[model samples]
Target: MKQWKLGLVVVLGISGLFSGRAIAAEEIILRYGILERTVAVSDLSQLAETGEATSQLQSYFDTAEVPAEEVQNMLNSDVTVDGVNINRILDNPLGDVLLDEVSKSIYPESGSAGRQAMRAALVLSAVDDDRITVIEVLENYPTSRVVLDTERLAETYEDFQEVGGVVVTVEDTLDDVLNVIRILETLSN
Candidate 1:
Protein backbone atom coordinates (compact mmCIF):
# COMPACT_ATOMS: atom_id res chain seq x y z
CA MET A 1 0.00 0.00 0.00
CA LYS A 2 1.17 3.54 -0.70
CA GLN A 3 1.93 5.76 2.25
CA TRP A 4 0.02 8.85 1.36
CA LYS A 5 0.33 10.23 4.86
CA LEU A 6 4.08 10.94 4.71
CA GLY A 7 3.83 14.15 2.74
CA LEU A 8 3.95 16.49 5.72
CA VAL A 9 6.51 19.04 8.96
CA VAL A 10 10.48 21.21 12.21
CA VAL A 11 11.81 23.64 14.91
CA LEU A 12 9.19 26.00 16.21
CA GLY A 13 8.00 22.43 15.17
CA ILE A 14 6.20 20.79 12.28
CA SER A 15 3.14 20.86 14.53
CA GLY A 16 3.40 24.60 15.05
CA LEU A 17 3.31 25.26 11.32
CA PHE A 18 0.21 23.08 10.77
CA SER A 19 -1.63 24.22 13.89
CA GLY A 20 -1.41 27.54 15.74
CA ARG A 21 -1.89 30.84 14.01
CA ALA A 22 1.19 32.98 13.71
CA ILE A 23 1.23 36.76 13.81
CA ALA A 24 1.61 38.00 10.28
CA ALA A 25 4.89 39.68 9.47
CA GLU A 26 4.72 43.40 8.80
CA GLU A 27 7.99 44.00 6.96
CA ILE A 28 10.80 42.09 5.31
CA ILE A 29 14.32 43.12 6.19
CA LEU A 30 16.50 42.42 3.19
CA ARG A 31 20.14 42.03 4.19
CA TYR A 32 23.35 41.72 2.23
CA GLY A 33 26.61 41.76 4.15
CA ILE A 34 26.69 44.97 6.21
CA LEU A 35 23.97 46.64 4.18
CA GLU A 36 20.30 46.22 5.13
CA ARG A 37 16.92 47.41 3.89
CA THR A 38 13.27 46.94 4.77
CA VAL A 39 10.23 46.42 2.56
CA ALA A 40 6.70 46.30 3.87
CA VAL A 41 4.86 43.03 3.41
CA SER A 42 2.05 44.97 1.77
CA ASP A 43 4.52 46.17 -0.85
CA LEU A 44 5.33 42.61 -1.75
CA SER A 45 1.67 41.66 -1.88
CA GLN A 46 0.98 44.48 -4.32
CA LEU A 47 3.83 43.41 -6.55
CA ALA A 48 2.65 39.80 -6.56
CA GLU A 49 -0.90 40.79 -7.37
CA THR A 50 -0.20 43.42 -10.03
CA GLY A 51 3.39 42.75 -11.15
CA GLU A 52 4.23 46.35 -10.35
CA ALA A 53 7.23 46.91 -8.10
CA THR A 54 7.06 49.81 -5.73
CA SER A 55 10.19 51.93 -5.37
CA GLN A 56 11.03 50.38 -2.03
CA LEU A 57 10.70 46.83 -3.35
CA GLN A 58 12.67 47.72 -6.47
CA SER A 59 15.42 49.14 -4.33
CA TYR A 60 15.80 45.80 -2.61
CA PHE A 61 16.31 44.02 -5.94
CA ASP A 62 18.97 46.56 -6.86
CA THR A 63 20.77 46.21 -3.52
CA ALA A 64 20.52 42.43 -3.38
CA GLU A 65 21.88 42.11 -6.93
CA VAL A 66 19.03 39.71 -7.64
CA PRO A 67 17.29 40.20 -10.96
CA ALA A 68 13.89 41.81 -10.56
CA GLU A 69 12.26 39.49 -13.04
CA GLU A 70 13.74 36.39 -11.42
CA VAL A 71 12.63 37.54 -8.00
CA GLN A 72 9.20 38.24 -9.38
CA ASN A 73 9.04 34.76 -10.82
CA MET A 74 9.94 33.48 -7.40
CA LEU A 75 7.37 35.70 -5.81
CA ASN A 76 4.54 34.19 -7.82
CA SER A 77 5.70 30.70 -8.74
CA ASP A 78 3.20 28.46 -6.98
CA VAL A 79 3.97 24.90 -5.87
CA THR A 80 0.91 22.78 -5.23
CA VAL A 81 1.34 20.54 -2.21
CA ASP A 82 -1.11 18.94 0.16
CA GLY A 83 -1.10 20.44 3.66
CA VAL A 84 -0.73 17.18 5.59
CA ASN A 85 2.10 15.89 3.42
CA ILE A 86 3.96 19.19 3.68
CA ASN A 87 3.60 19.11 7.43
CA ARG A 88 5.03 15.57 7.61
CA ILE A 89 8.05 16.33 5.45
CA LEU A 90 8.87 19.51 7.34
CA ASP A 91 8.57 17.85 10.75
CA ASN A 92 11.30 15.29 10.10
CA PRO A 93 15.12 15.56 10.39
CA LEU A 94 15.51 16.05 6.65
CA GLY A 95 12.86 18.69 6.88
CA ASP A 96 14.96 20.38 9.52
CA VAL A 97 17.89 20.39 7.09
CA LEU A 98 15.76 22.08 4.46
CA LEU A 99 14.48 24.52 7.07
CA ASP A 100 18.02 25.30 8.20
CA GLU A 101 19.06 26.14 4.65
CA VAL A 102 16.03 28.32 3.94
CA SER A 103 16.11 30.06 7.28
CA LYS A 104 19.61 31.16 6.40
CA SER A 105 18.00 33.49 3.91
CA ILE A 106 14.43 34.19 5.09
CA TYR A 107 14.12 34.30 8.84
CA PRO A 108 13.07 36.44 11.75
CA GLU A 109 15.04 39.50 12.94
CA SER A 110 16.59 37.48 15.74
CA GLY A 111 18.25 35.18 13.16
CA SER A 112 18.45 32.21 15.54
CA ALA A 113 14.74 31.64 15.21
CA GLY A 114 15.05 31.22 11.47
CA ARG A 115 14.50 27.44 11.44
CA GLN A 116 11.15 27.41 13.22
CA ALA A 117 10.00 30.63 11.63
CA MET A 118 10.80 29.33 8.19
CA ARG A 119 8.79 26.20 8.91
CA ALA A 120 5.81 28.24 10.01
CA ALA A 121 6.04 30.57 7.05
CA LEU A 122 6.10 27.74 4.52
CA VAL A 123 3.37 25.69 6.18
CA LEU A 124 1.06 28.65 6.70
CA SER A 125 1.66 29.87 3.20
CA ALA A 126 0.84 26.43 1.83
CA VAL A 127 -2.22 26.42 4.04
CA ASP A 128 -3.50 29.60 2.39
CA ASP A 129 -4.25 28.38 -1.12
CA ASP A 130 -3.30 24.71 -1.26
CA ARG A 131 -0.09 26.04 -2.78
CA ILE A 132 2.99 27.89 -1.62
CA THR A 133 5.02 30.69 -3.21
CA VAL A 134 7.87 32.89 -2.14
CA ILE A 135 5.49 35.76 -1.58
CA GLU A 136 3.08 33.59 0.37
CA VAL A 137 5.93 32.48 2.63
CA LEU A 138 6.87 36.09 3.29
CA GLU A 139 3.28 37.06 3.99
CA ASN A 140 2.89 34.29 6.56
CA TYR A 141 6.24 34.77 8.20
CA PRO A 142 5.55 34.25 11.89
CA THR A 143 7.07 37.41 13.23
CA SER A 144 6.86 41.16 13.02
CA ARG A 145 10.01 41.41 10.93
CA VAL A 146 11.12 38.81 8.40
CA VAL A 147 14.69 38.85 7.10
CA LEU A 148 15.80 37.72 3.68
CA ASP A 149 19.48 37.41 2.79
CA THR A 150 19.70 38.07 -0.90
CA GLU A 151 23.13 36.46 -1.12
CA ARG A 152 21.97 33.15 0.34
CA LEU A 153 18.82 32.65 -1.71
CA ALA A 154 20.46 30.46 -4.32
CA GLU A 155 20.73 27.51 -1.94
CA THR A 156 17.25 28.10 -0.62
CA TYR A 157 15.96 28.00 -4.15
CA GLU A 158 17.77 24.75 -4.82
CA ASP A 159 16.32 23.23 -1.68
CA PHE A 160 12.84 24.22 -2.76
CA GLN A 161 13.42 22.50 -6.07
CA GLU A 162 14.04 19.35 -4.11
CA VAL A 163 10.68 19.40 -2.35
CA GLY A 164 9.29 16.90 -4.82
CA GLY A 165 12.24 14.60 -4.31
CA VAL A 166 11.98 14.91 -0.55
CA VAL A 167 8.36 13.91 -0.60
CA VAL A 168 9.02 10.84 -2.70
CA THR A 169 11.99 9.85 -0.58
CA VAL A 170 10.08 10.19 2.67
CA GLU A 171 7.19 8.08 1.44
CA ASP A 172 9.52 5.35 0.18
CA THR A 173 11.34 5.27 3.49
CA LEU A 174 8.14 5.01 5.44
CA ASP A 175 6.91 2.15 3.27
CA ASP A 176 10.19 0.31 3.64
CA VAL A 177 10.22 0.65 7.41
CA LEU A 178 6.63 -0.38 7.76
CA ASN A 179 7.20 -3.38 5.52
CA VAL A 180 10.13 -4.53 7.62
CA ILE A 181 8.12 -4.22 10.79
CA ARG A 182 5.38 -6.31 9.27
CA ILE A 183 7.80 -9.01 8.17
CA LEU A 184 9.45 -9.10 11.59
CA GLU A 185 6.12 -9.37 13.31
CA THR A 186 5.07 -12.18 10.98
CA LEU A 187 8.27 -14.09 11.80
CA SER A 188 7.70 -13.69 15.55
CA ASN A 189 4.09 -14.74 15.27
Candidate 2:
Protein backbone atom coordinates (compact mmCIF):
# COMPACT_ATOMS: atom_id res chain seq x y z
CA MET A 1 0.00 0.00 0.00
CA LYS A 2 2.84 2.40 0.81
CA GLN A 3 4.59 1.76 -2.47
CA TRP A 4 1.39 2.20 -4.44
CA LYS A 5 0.64 5.53 -2.75
CA LEU A 6 4.18 6.78 -3.47
CA GLY A 7 3.86 5.85 -7.13
CA LEU A 8 0.55 7.67 -7.37
CA VAL A 9 1.98 10.78 -5.77
CA VAL A 10 4.92 10.83 -8.19
CA VAL A 11 2.62 10.48 -11.16
CA LEU A 12 0.42 13.31 -9.97
CA GLY A 13 3.41 15.54 -9.34
CA ILE A 14 4.77 14.99 -12.82
CA SER A 15 1.40 15.74 -14.35
CA GLY A 16 1.10 18.94 -12.35
CA LEU A 17 4.50 20.11 -13.53
CA PHE A 18 3.58 20.05 -17.19
CA SER A 19 -0.15 20.70 -16.89
CA GLY A 20 -1.22 21.73 -20.45
CA ARG A 21 1.77 23.87 -21.26
CA ALA A 22 4.25 23.56 -24.06
CA ILE A 23 7.89 22.67 -23.43
CA ALA A 24 9.47 25.39 -21.29
CA ALA A 25 12.38 27.38 -22.68
CA GLU A 26 15.55 25.28 -22.63
CA GLU A 27 18.01 27.70 -24.24
CA ILE A 28 18.28 31.36 -25.13
CA ILE A 29 19.98 32.63 -28.26
CA LEU A 30 21.77 35.83 -27.33
CA ARG A 31 22.32 38.08 -30.32
CA TYR A 32 24.51 41.13 -30.60
CA GLY A 33 25.36 42.58 -33.99
CA ILE A 34 26.54 39.65 -36.12
CA LEU A 35 27.50 37.56 -33.13
CA GLU A 36 25.22 35.01 -31.52
CA ARG A 37 25.58 32.42 -28.79
CA THR A 38 23.13 29.79 -27.58
CA VAL A 39 23.02 29.51 -23.80
CA ALA A 40 21.19 26.94 -21.73
CA VAL A 41 18.47 28.39 -19.52
CA SER A 42 19.66 26.13 -16.69
CA ASP A 43 23.10 27.76 -16.72
CA LEU A 44 21.56 31.22 -16.45
CA SER A 45 19.25 30.07 -13.68
CA GLN A 46 22.16 28.61 -11.75
CA LEU A 47 24.15 31.80 -12.11
CA ALA A 48 21.22 33.87 -10.84
CA GLU A 49 20.70 31.61 -7.81
CA THR A 50 24.40 31.30 -7.10
CA GLY A 51 26.79 34.12 -7.97
CA GLU A 52 29.19 31.94 -9.94
CA ALA A 53 29.16 31.70 -13.68
CA THR A 54 30.10 28.36 -15.19
CA SER A 55 33.00 27.79 -17.63
CA GLN A 56 30.52 27.38 -20.46
CA LEU A 57 29.05 30.82 -19.69
CA GLN A 58 32.33 32.48 -18.76
CA SER A 59 33.24 33.69 -22.23
CA TYR A 60 29.89 35.37 -22.60
CA PHE A 61 30.35 36.89 -19.19
CA ASP A 62 33.73 38.26 -20.22
CA THR A 63 32.25 39.80 -23.36
CA ALA A 64 29.38 41.44 -21.51
CA GLU A 65 29.68 45.19 -21.22
CA VAL A 66 27.67 45.29 -17.98
CA PRO A 67 29.49 44.33 -14.81
CA ALA A 68 28.81 40.92 -13.33
CA GLU A 69 27.32 42.36 -10.17
CA GLU A 70 24.80 44.47 -12.06
CA VAL A 71 23.85 41.47 -14.14
CA GLN A 72 23.34 39.49 -10.97
CA ASN A 73 21.19 42.23 -9.49
CA MET A 74 18.96 42.31 -12.54
CA LEU A 75 18.53 38.56 -12.59
CA ASN A 76 17.99 38.16 -8.87
CA SER A 77 15.52 41.03 -8.43
CA ASP A 78 11.86 40.05 -8.35
CA VAL A 79 8.41 41.58 -8.08
CA THR A 80 5.27 40.33 -6.38
CA VAL A 81 2.80 39.53 -9.13
CA ASP A 82 -0.69 38.12 -9.53
CA GLY A 83 -1.55 36.01 -12.56
CA VAL A 84 -5.05 37.40 -12.86
CA ASN A 85 -3.97 41.03 -12.67
CA ILE A 86 -1.21 40.30 -15.14
CA ASN A 87 -3.69 38.78 -17.56
CA ARG A 88 -6.04 41.74 -17.23
CA ILE A 89 -3.29 44.31 -17.57
CA LEU A 90 -1.71 42.74 -20.62
CA ASP A 91 -5.00 42.82 -22.52
CA ASN A 92 -5.28 46.59 -22.34
CA PRO A 93 -3.83 49.37 -24.53
CA LEU A 94 -1.05 50.46 -22.21
CA GLY A 95 -0.11 46.86 -21.65
CA ASP A 96 0.06 46.35 -25.41
CA VAL A 97 2.54 49.19 -25.68
CA LEU A 98 4.61 47.84 -22.83
CA LEU A 99 4.55 44.39 -24.36
CA ASP A 100 5.71 45.79 -27.68
CA GLU A 101 8.66 47.44 -26.05
CA VAL A 102 9.61 44.40 -23.99
CA SER A 103 9.08 41.96 -26.83
CA LYS A 104 11.70 43.70 -28.91
CA SER A 105 14.35 42.46 -26.50
CA ILE A 106 13.28 39.00 -25.42
CA TYR A 107 11.00 36.95 -27.62
CA PRO A 108 10.46 33.57 -29.18
CA GLU A 109 11.88 32.71 -32.58
CA SER A 110 8.53 33.42 -34.22
CA GLY A 111 8.61 37.04 -33.03
CA SER A 112 4.86 37.51 -33.38
CA ALA A 113 3.89 35.65 -30.22
CA GLY A 114 6.14 37.69 -28.00
CA ARG A 115 3.50 39.34 -25.83
CA GLN A 116 1.42 36.20 -25.40
CA ALA A 117 4.46 34.15 -24.51
CA MET A 118 5.70 36.85 -22.14
CA ARG A 119 2.33 36.98 -20.42
CA ALA A 120 2.21 33.20 -20.08
CA ALA A 121 5.74 33.10 -18.70
CA LEU A 122 5.03 35.81 -16.14
CA VAL A 123 1.76 34.18 -15.11
CA LEU A 124 3.23 30.70 -14.82
CA SER A 125 6.21 31.90 -12.81
CA ALA A 126 3.94 33.60 -10.27
CA VAL A 127 1.64 30.63 -9.86
CA ASP A 128 3.56 29.13 -6.96
CA ASP A 129 5.33 31.97 -5.15
CA ASP A 130 3.53 35.15 -6.22
CA ARG A 131 7.02 36.39 -6.98
CA ILE A 132 8.29 36.83 -10.53
CA THR A 133 11.97 37.13 -11.34
CA VAL A 134 13.73 37.47 -14.66
CA ILE A 135 15.17 33.99 -14.22
CA GLU A 136 11.75 32.52 -13.56
CA VAL A 137 10.26 34.23 -16.61
CA LEU A 138 13.02 32.79 -18.77
CA GLU A 139 12.56 29.35 -17.27
CA ASN A 140 8.79 29.30 -17.70
CA TYR A 141 8.73 30.85 -21.19
CA PRO A 142 6.23 28.95 -23.27
CA THR A 143 8.56 28.11 -26.10
CA SER A 144 11.35 25.58 -26.24
CA ARG A 145 13.56 28.24 -27.80
CA VAL A 146 13.88 31.95 -26.96
CA VAL A 147 15.97 34.87 -28.12
CA LEU A 148 17.62 37.62 -26.16
CA ASP A 149 18.66 40.62 -28.18
CA THR A 150 21.54 42.13 -26.28
CA GLU A 151 21.23 45.58 -27.78
CA ARG A 152 17.72 46.05 -26.44
CA LEU A 153 17.75 43.90 -23.29
CA ALA A 154 18.82 46.69 -20.93
CA GLU A 155 16.23 49.07 -22.31
CA THR A 156 13.54 46.42 -22.07
CA TYR A 157 14.50 45.80 -18.46
CA GLU A 158 13.74 49.44 -17.74
CA ASP A 159 10.41 49.26 -19.52
CA PHE A 160 9.58 46.14 -17.53
CA GLN A 161 9.84 48.22 -14.37
CA GLU A 162 6.89 50.29 -15.49
CA VAL A 163 4.78 47.18 -15.79
CA GLY A 164 5.92 46.04 -12.37
CA GLY A 165 4.94 49.38 -10.92
CA VAL A 166 1.50 49.07 -12.40
CA VAL A 167 1.12 45.67 -10.82
CA VAL A 168 2.09 47.06 -7.44
CA THR A 169 -0.41 49.88 -7.76
CA VAL A 170 -3.13 47.43 -8.73
CA GLU A 171 -2.34 45.22 -5.75
CA ASP A 172 -2.71 48.19 -3.45
CA THR A 173 -5.94 49.35 -4.99
CA LEU A 174 -7.52 45.89 -5.37
CA ASP A 175 -6.74 44.50 -1.92
CA ASP A 176 -10.31 44.76 -0.61
CA VAL A 177 -12.08 43.63 -3.74
CA LEU A 178 -13.42 40.48 -2.08
CA ASN A 179 -11.28 37.83 -3.79
CA VAL A 180 -12.57 38.83 -7.21
CA ILE A 181 -9.06 38.79 -8.64
CA ARG A 182 -8.59 35.14 -7.68
CA ILE A 183 -11.87 34.17 -9.26
CA LEU A 184 -11.11 36.17 -12.40
CA GLU A 185 -7.74 34.53 -12.66
CA THR A 186 -9.35 31.11 -12.81
CA LEU A 187 -12.06 32.20 -15.24
CA SER A 188 -9.53 33.98 -17.44
CA ASN A 189 -7.60 30.76 -17.81
TM-score to native of every candidate shown: 0.73, 0.75
Off by over 4 Å in 2: 1-22, 175-189
Model 1 regions lying over 4 Å from their true place = 1-22, 63-65, 172-189
Q: Write the per-residue lDDT of candidate 2 for residues 1-189, one digit (tens) a residue.
A: 345434533543454367554447899897876778898998888889887777767777677655656666777778777644565666778778877787788899878779877766776666666677888888878787899887787778877776788778877787857587788888999
**Residue 55, model 1: Cα distance from true site in angstroms:** 1.5
lDDT of 1: 0.74
Cα TM-score of candidate 2: 0.75
How many clashes in each candidate? 14, 0
Q: Among these predicted structures, which one has the highest TM-score? A: 2
